[model samples]
Target: MAALIMVDEPSVQGGRRVSVFRRGREEHLGTAFSDHDVIVFLQAAGLSDPEEVLDDPRWVEWSGGRDWKRPPMR
Candidate 1:
């Protein structure tokens, strides 16, 4: 039942999505994208610190995790 509430905010389909975070009565929503777009932009702006991720070339996203480690590629 609680999980259903999280899916209320529909994703941008093949684009960015606005998702809400739950914390008591304090709910905060943010954008969720399906690409490495933010990574490049953030990196170019010097905001994506930890050059490891910015230079790895293998990690091409803001997901802050490994690509191969993704869940079932689903």
Candidate 2:
């Protein structure tokens, strides 16, 4: 594992903030508010099939801790 991380913060627009970190360093993975956004982020992170990573139990557990609000698909 490359120490990939995801975190959520309160956004100014009442939406949520989703950040990605790797190797304990913050990565500017961009604004992720939906599954698609996360998938894109994952792809950029190196995974070809984002859903596979999303479906992983380890990722599921980590994502649960973020408490990020998933927005509707755009």
Candidate 3:
């Protein structure tokens, strides 16, 4: 089975950073400033090709909105 990557909603107070976690795990892998950063985090975590992982639904699961660049203020 493919690894499940969970990306939380962006936090405005945190400089619009989003928390990244592996599904079913409590601890987050890291935080990212944008979608591209997500890929870098995943790579640093020893995952497969970052771009491919980000583009694959089987690997990534996003919360709130996918627009990490300018997430809607909540």
Candidate 4:
């Protein structure tokens, strides 16, 4: 079976960022500051066609929805 990736909700504590994790793993793969960063992270993790990976539910599970745009500062 293909590896499952999880994109967590965006956090604004120290600027807007999203955490990427492998399902069932304790440690995260990395934090992404932008949508591009997420693609890069996935590429580094050996996933080809990052765009398709992001869209496919079988590969990625987006928490709190997939909002690539960074939220406005408070």
Best candidate, lDDT: 4
Off by over 4 Å in 2: 1-3, 9-15, 60-74
Pairwise TM-score winner, candidates 2 and 3: 3
The stretch of ten residues in a row with the least summed lDDT in candidate 2 is 57-66
Cα lDDT for residue 24, candidate 4: 57
Model 3 C-alpha lDDT per residue in residues 1-74, reported as the tens digit of each score:
64377777767643333334555564566777766777777777787787876757677767666665464568
- How many clashing pairs does model 2 include? 0
Ten contiguous residues minimizing lDDT sum, candidate 1: 1-10
TM-score, model 2 to reference: 0.54
Flag regions of model 1 displaced more than 4 Å.
1-10, 17-35, 48-74
Number of backbone-clashing residue pairs for each candidate, in the order shown: 0, 0, 0, 0
Candidates ranked, most accurate by lDDT first: 4, 3, 2, 1
Which ranges in model 4 have alpha carbons more than 4 Å from their true place?
1-3, 14-27, 69-74
lDDT string for model 4 (10-66, tens) is 776422333345555644567776667878877887778898777787777777677
Best by TM-score: 4
Q: What is the C-alpha lDDT of each candidate?
A: 0.33, 0.57, 0.65, 0.67
